[model samples]
Target: MNTVLETIKNRRSIRSYLPEQISGDELETVLEAALWAPSGHNTQPWHFLVIQDKKKIDDMSSKTISLMKKSPVDWIQKLASREGYHLFHNAPTVIVISGRKSADPLLFPLADCSAAIQNLLLAAESLNIGTCWIGLSKFLFDVPEEVKTLSLPEGYHPVYSVALGYKKEQLRPTAPARKEGTVGWYRA
Candidate 1:
């Protein structure tokens, strides 16, 4: 198999990570890939916040769990009680992806930002860095106070957050079988 195909096939969402910090160069490479992702009409609507401070990351996770505790949903409440339930899985760094409302039409900015996130994930995988897109913790960024704490600019809204670190586990699990009928071809 080709190298890019191999990378794509092997990339996995890593939840367990070592305590070591990712080197600055590796972080830069991943961010660079994000910056280069294709955007709608070249609008490039995404903004990234790279948080490396463990204390700050922990506080964000705590706030997310706190909010979860008040939810009417049973599953959410249960998840909040789980032991060792840090939203980032104790990863050393997190990159928060956001989009500006004015960057494009309502949906385009989000689509562009999502493309950038995929680029970031693939780049990290190539660098032997582990990444997991954490949708559960995005609630932290949705709150008015949390948005202010994140220091996101006016008009910018949180789309997603990703945890980053080096994998602690040596053996990566193989990819599961892809869902059938998820693809189709157009022929003339």
Candidate 2:
């Protein structure tokens, strides 16, 4: 099998991480991968906000959990109130990805952002780093004040975020059987 394909198959979403921070070089490599991700018309409408401050990361996690608690969805509320739950899973760093407002409106913004995110995730996985997409932080993007705290430039919108760090323990999740009936063929 191809090395890239093998890496993709082995990659898993890491939820637990060690307290040690990732080296600048490793983070840069991941960012470089993201920068090279395919974009519509080469708009490359993505900006990465890397937050390495432990205090700030913790604060964001706490705030996200607090907000989750108020969600009307039972699952979200319960999960938010559960003990030993951190939205970022105590990762040493968080990278917030934003889509540039100047991107062509006709082009796909979220899809472009997703491609960059996938590149970052795969790059981290290949480098022995762990990463998990913290979708729980999505709510924060809609809040103007919270967005300001990220210091994103004008005309940029937060799309998603990922927590990155060294794994605290080996993450070898049992392979679940893939669901069937999800594929289709259009060849005629």
Which residue pairs come into collision in candidate 2? none
lDDT of 1 by residue, 30-146 (tens): 999999999888989899999999999999999999998888889998998899898899999999999878733445887899999999999999888999998887668668888
What's the TM for model 1? Answer: 0.93
Per-prediction TM-score, please? 0.93, 0.95
Per-prediction CA RMSD (Å) = 1.6, 1.3
The C-alpha local distance difference test score for the whole of candidate 1 amounts to 0.89
Clashes of each: 0, 0
Rate residue 154 of model 2 by lDDT: 83
Q: Give the alpha carbon lDDT tens digit for every residue of 132-186 in model 2.
A: 9877788778788999988888888998999999988785665567899999999
lDDT for residue 32 in candidate 1, whole number 0-100: 99
lDDT of candidates 1 onward, in order: 0.89, 0.89
